[model samples]
Target: MNTENARSQPPHEPSGCLTGVARGIALVVVLPVRLVWDALAFCLRQLWRWVLAPVGRALGWLIDVLLVTPLRWLWEWVLVPVGRALWWLVDTVLLTPLGWLWRWVLLPVAKGVWWVVDLLLVTPLTWLWRYVLAPVGRAVGAALAWAWHIAGVISRAVGRAVGWVLWNVIGRPLAWTYRVVLTPVGHWLRTWVWAPVAAAARAVRAAAREVRVALFGGSR
Candidate 1:
């Protein structure tokens, strides 16, 4: 009997309170986010349609029709013939003349001048050098060589005598004096002058260390 009563009851529907709460949450969280997204999309669509697309199409048409068409016609009609005419003019006027001058005038003249110089001046000068000046130069060079040898021998003997005198008179006496007298003076200077300076330097360093330790708060 209880089972039959339960089957006979109708299906339950949600309450108004829960449904109102769900609608409130949707308004707070989802509605504002969706509204903002729709506004941004509308703005972007309007920008592309009104501003960017028209400008892009105009620039593309200008580049293709106005600029590229005229350039192609100019290159074919004007530039090709002008370049060929300029090349022909340069070759006919400048290069041909220069080639003729080099082959006929400049080269022949240079060769003739070289031949004359060789025959007149160079051969005579070579003969003079080989026969006349060379023998005289050799004789003078032999005399100079003898004089240089004698001078070198005398110079070496004088240098030896000077060296001997310097060693005996100056160097030996100075060495002996340094060993006997100056050594004691140098030791006295170190013991008195240098030792006091060194001790002062060490004391200053120790004082600086103490000051640094005090400033930094470190153990001694």
Candidate 2:
């Protein structure tokens, strides 16, 4: 039992020693980085608290004093007064005169011009289009439609007449000639001429074969 305990204890001692060494090395490696991070954080805090904050406050004060106050003064005093004066001047000089001219002079003249145009141009044109042009266009259209219908009828009649004439004069004669003359002639020529010629050709071939067989003393 003691021997076994000694062996196990030796293994655990080596592990503990290794653990201690690893921890010491890790602490040594991390110490400088931790110090550097802390120092940087402290510097950033001090910079924000002392330098940046006071400077931002001073800049805001300067802007308020220089830009914002002056602009507010200009808007309140200079711009407002000048704008009002210019508006009053425009209203009294230009706008008033223009309004008067438009109301009294231009309005009546424009109405008279419009009335003259309506009377001389628009009304006469409307009357012409309504009474004269519309009736004439309708009459011409009707006449053209009637003429077109009559022409279509005449064309159809002429086409049918031509077809009938062709069928009677040319088509019927050609059909009769083919049926009455050509068909019988073709049949007679085939039966008498072609049959005898084919038979004579066959006989000539047979006689030549026989003569050759006799001369050569062979079957073919």
Candidate 3:
């Protein structure tokens, strides 16, 4: 068992030598690239911190001095007073007069026009609808209902009369003819004529059967 274990153990020296060679090669290949990356990062940080930041700050200050400050002053001093004066002028000149006219003249005129329209048109129309049209409509409706009732009565009476006439004139005669004439005729034919004919046929058939038996002899 000890010899078998020794035989199964794997060799390690060649693999260890190969691994060391690979690590050395990787270090040699990566050293220059790492140095170049570090240098580029340092340059970018310095450029942003010193050159680009100072330029941005100078530009912001110049813009504030040249454009923003003057515009702010103009808005605070010139535009505000001009706006206030214009608003005052408009209020005194236009709005006050228009308000006064609306309150004094136009309001009264509008009220008068509305009053005239209501008196002339609305009142008359209301009276006509209430007193005349409504009553007339009710009367017309009642008359139409009465006429319809009368028509229904007349129609019913006519139908009853027609039904009575048909029964007396046509139905009774047909019933009597069937009961008196056709029934007796049918019974007599069945009793006398049909019975005699049937009896004769039976006698002939029997005679034929006897002659056949006499000639041909009886069945086996």
Better candidate by TM-score, 1 or 2 = 2
Write down the TM-score of every candidate.
0.47, 0.59, 0.51
lDDT of 2 by residue, 22-101 (tens): 99999999999999999999999999999999999999999999999999999999999999999999999999999999
Q: Write the per-residue lDDT of candidate 3 for residues 1-220, one digit (tens) a residue.
A: 9999878878653577898999899989998899999999999999989999999999999999999999999999999999999999999999999999999999999999999999999999999999999999999999999999999999999999998999889988888988999899989998999999999999999888889888997852
Worst 10 residues of 3 by lDDT: 6-15
CA lDDT, candidate 1, residue 29: 99
- Model 3 residue pairs with clashes: none
Clashing pairs in 1: none
lDDT of each: 0.93, 0.96, 0.92
TM-score between candidate 3 and the true structure = 0.51
Residue-pair clashes per candidate:
0, 0, 0
Provide the lDDT at 146 for model 3.
99
- lDDT comparison, 1 vs 2, better candidate: 2
Displacement of residue 142 (Cα, Å) in model 3 is 2.3
